[model samples]
Target chain A: MYIIGELINGMYRNVREALAERDASAIKTLARRQVEAGADALDVNCGPLSKDPVQDMRWLVEAIQSEVAVPLCLDSTKQAVIEEGLKACRGKAIINSTTADTDKLDAYLALALKHRASLIALTVDKKGVPQDKERRLELAAFILERAAGAGLDAAELYLDPVLLPVNVAQNQLEDILRVIGDFKLLTTPAVKSVVGLSNISQGSKNRSIINRTFLVMAQAAGLEAAILDPLDQELMRSLITGALILNKAIYCDSYIEAYLKSKLKS
Target chain B: MAEELKMITTWSQAVCEMRLGAGRQEGGSRKVTLTVGGEETLPFLFKEGALPHTPLIAVEIFDVPQDDEPEALRRDLRGISKDPVTWAKAMVEDIGADLVCVKLAGIHPDGANTSAGQAVNLVTKILGAVDRPLIVLGCGEAGRDNEVLPLVSEATKGERLLFGDAVQENYKTLTAACIADGHNIIAESPIDVNIAKQLNILISDLGMPLDRIIINPTIGALGYGLEYAYSIMERARNAALSGDRMLAMPFICFVGQESWRAKEAKVPASESPAWGDQRERGIMWEVVTAMSCLQAGADILTMRHPQAIKIVKSEIQELMKKAQS
Candidate 1:
């Protein structure tokens, strides 16, 4: 599993204070910790409170890149902010998202090709996140069609079904799971799939348990990546166990420890 | 024109490379060192992946002569020398074995009951007599191996000997000794796949890296459950190529020990006239067992008869050749 650490975002209290004070050291330390905790990449977000989203995105990308060699996932709604983050990245960066809208697809694809970065496109168009599996797959197919037209390698694209909170949209959870697997069939050597795992536990009493359970279920459905808190030991262990059950990883008595050590080497 | 379909499977991981016997520049006395493993594809599918090294043959020598040893093997041993040092030298010099495997069977409680000091003295003498890379294995009894392996491992510290037969139930002491003395270990698992993986993990957990370990999947003689052993080895190679890190180490098979123990190899010609000459049949048995192991991903083969070693070694050269495509 490609785990993008979600702890570096400014939405967290410590990250918010670090962004306010422009404490690059705090951002650097968080980046290193996540990488040590087995994150394949880190998600750099400026949060909703950033007065200067473009500048803050660039700063976060630079700070994290300086501390760890892992790629940064430039998380932002605005194309300009993500583009700024991409320019500062010393290595390939991930464009957090775009929608199925033709205009947005055109803009993001151009940025992705120009920077040679992977793009994560959500299965949501101008109408907003779909509540059913069929609509979500339709949006994913549309995004992929645009990518093909632009001559983008299907492997460079990650499709997120935009999962809603289980507390409010309990009926849509199963549909989202199906959507994740269907995205792979949309192409040969199927397109990768990812999810912002915290979205499922939003407004839940037992957030950790809900998030862990959903992550494993999505993994069984062949989700390729996740933006999650790598420091969550129980959640990380569950992810490792899920991969083992799927035969994606070798089983050992100390498999979790083995995975962690392998991360350090790579 | 009809469209042709081509399917190519890609592997994300390859078996880890392990070098046996360190040379003078690397702080050991051996004149030769062999590097094994590092195959990205299954054995000899060169069109798919690189096979960096050919499989090796290690002639097995016992510290003490076996009373029940078949006459075919006894004839071969009589031509050479039964003494450990002279036998190791003849195996390397005359027999042309790529490596020498000294089986310290005399140290077993049921056998001559030799002391650890005697085993260590014999290992050091053989290391001096033969400059080839060495593989030192203990008696099958875990209790005695646990006692004898540490002393022998410490005696040949920088020689980089491959000490083994460390099983799931008794690996802690041998693994620690190998680690402390800077030697490689052979992890023995019965025909079961899960136990093979588990033993490797247990050995590695004691601060021993996976690259310094080889898996002994415990094979059977040809026609004596060889197909079952073949399946396990093939499954292990498939798992390794499919990215199972713990199962990715190179395999070592004791072809001579298993093949010779079969009644078919030991019966006299007068007893079974239809079975043909006992010596030739026994040699062919070892050769056939060794050949099957090579195809099933054996990086190292331990054999007894000189004629069988020559046949298996020549066959390895033939199999290592890649197709023109």
Candidate 2:
């Protein structure tokens, strides 16, 4: 699985204070730990606490990249903040993300093409998260059609079926799983799929158990990547176990050890 | 509504291209050099990536006459098996091999126990007899191999030859020799991708260039753990294409060595009447092994039988045609 470490975002208390105090070392520490935890990439977000998200995003990118070589996923609803973060990112940066809206997709596609970066496009539109598989597939089709019409390779595109809190969006969770599998048929060469794992268990009791269950089930439903806390030992173990069960990894008596070592391959 | 169906593709980062055998001005004296690696995707996955080069075949020739206990195994090379020079000559002039492999089996203490001088002489004779690029392999013993393989490597300096089976336990001497001699090295691992990659990482950490490395993931003949070997090579090759430099060198499989050793290939037809003629059965045995290795992304197949080599060459031609021009 392509794991993106989701710890550097300002939504967290430590990251929020780090952003306020302009702590580069704090950000670097998180970056190193996540990378050490086997994150293929790091997600950087200024969150709502930043007065100037563009400045904060740039600092996060440079601070993390200054110490580590892994790619950074620039997380922001604003395309300009993502673009500014891209300018600061030394290597390839993932633009996370855009919805099925045409204008939003056109702008993000242009930025992705100009920067030669991969994109995470959510299966959402002006109508918000779809409640059924057909609607989700339709929005996914729109993203693929527009991305392709814009000359982006499907491989370069990663489609996300928006994951909402299980406490509030229980009815739509099944549709999310179904859409993840059917999304492959929406385009040729199959657009990759990723999910923000924490979104599943937000505001729910037994969050770790809920999150792990959703991750494994989503993986079985064909999720190729995920935005999650690699520091969460149980979650990462479940992800590794799910991958083994899916035959993505060759079996060995010491497969967990092997996977841990090779997961560091970026 | 009717619509046209099209298969799109994903762009995989290409594997490194490794050049073997430096000619006169460059260093070696081979009439024709060979190159491998440089695949952008899994083997023959045309829609996903480009297969830049078809796998090359290097027929194996030993320095001293090997045991030919089974009369059926030596029937094809009865006269040629007696001398390294004659066998190598027939390998290039008659078999149409892409390259030649000289095994210093005689240098092993268990056998002819030939000295370094004798091993060097045999190597010189084969090099003189065949102008194709050469791959020189040592015996199975690491300690003994460490002793003589270096001398042969030094004697054949500037030939840009490919040296064999550098394992984790015995790579330092050979890697240094390869670097100093201006030749390539093949890092061999048991049928395990992790060990295969770890060996490459160790070799590359020696500060020698990675392009001079080839991977021998080890071979198991058909019906003899072939799938295990195939998966190891495939996974390692996939990792290489996926941008892991340590796992990315073109793979070299000892196809002929492993295939011809199988009981199915050595036993007589009368022993198993259900099986076909022993000669044809043995030939098919090697062909199937070589062909399977080709499918698993072997960049160099060191084969034995001339007829098996011919069939494999033709099959590779047909398989490669499926790639986009």
Clashing residue pairs in candidate 1 (N, C-alpha, C atoms within 3 angstroms): none
Report the C-alpha displacement of residue B101, candidate 1, in angstroms: 0.5
lDDT for B65 in candidate 1 is 81
* Docking quality category of candidate 2 according to DockQ thresholds: incorrect
Against the native chain B, what TM-score does each candidate's chain B reach? 0.96, 0.94
Regions of model 1 farther than 4 Å from truth: B1-6, B323-325
How is the predicted docking of candidate 1 categorized under the CAPRI scheme? Answer: acceptable
DockQ for model 2?
A: 0.10
Tens-place lDDT per residue, model 2, A1-266, is: 89999999989999999999989999999999999887999999999878999988988898999999988899999877998999998897899999989999999999999898999999888888888889888888888888889998888889998899999989999989988889888776678999999998989999999999999999999999999999999888888888879976655445555567555554
- Over B1-325, each residue of candidate 2 has an lDDT whose tens digit, in order, gives 2232265445445777888777888867887877898888877777666788988999888877777635555878889888878888887788788888888888788888888888877888788878878899888788888888889889989988899879878899999998888889988888888777777767766866878988889889998889999988878776666545667678898888888889998888788888879998888898999889888888999988888888888888887887755
- Model 2, position B120: C-alpha lDDT score: 79
Q: Locate the minimum summed-lDDT window of 10 residues in model 1 chain B.
A: B1-10
i-RMS values of the candidates, in order? Answer: 2.7, 4.9
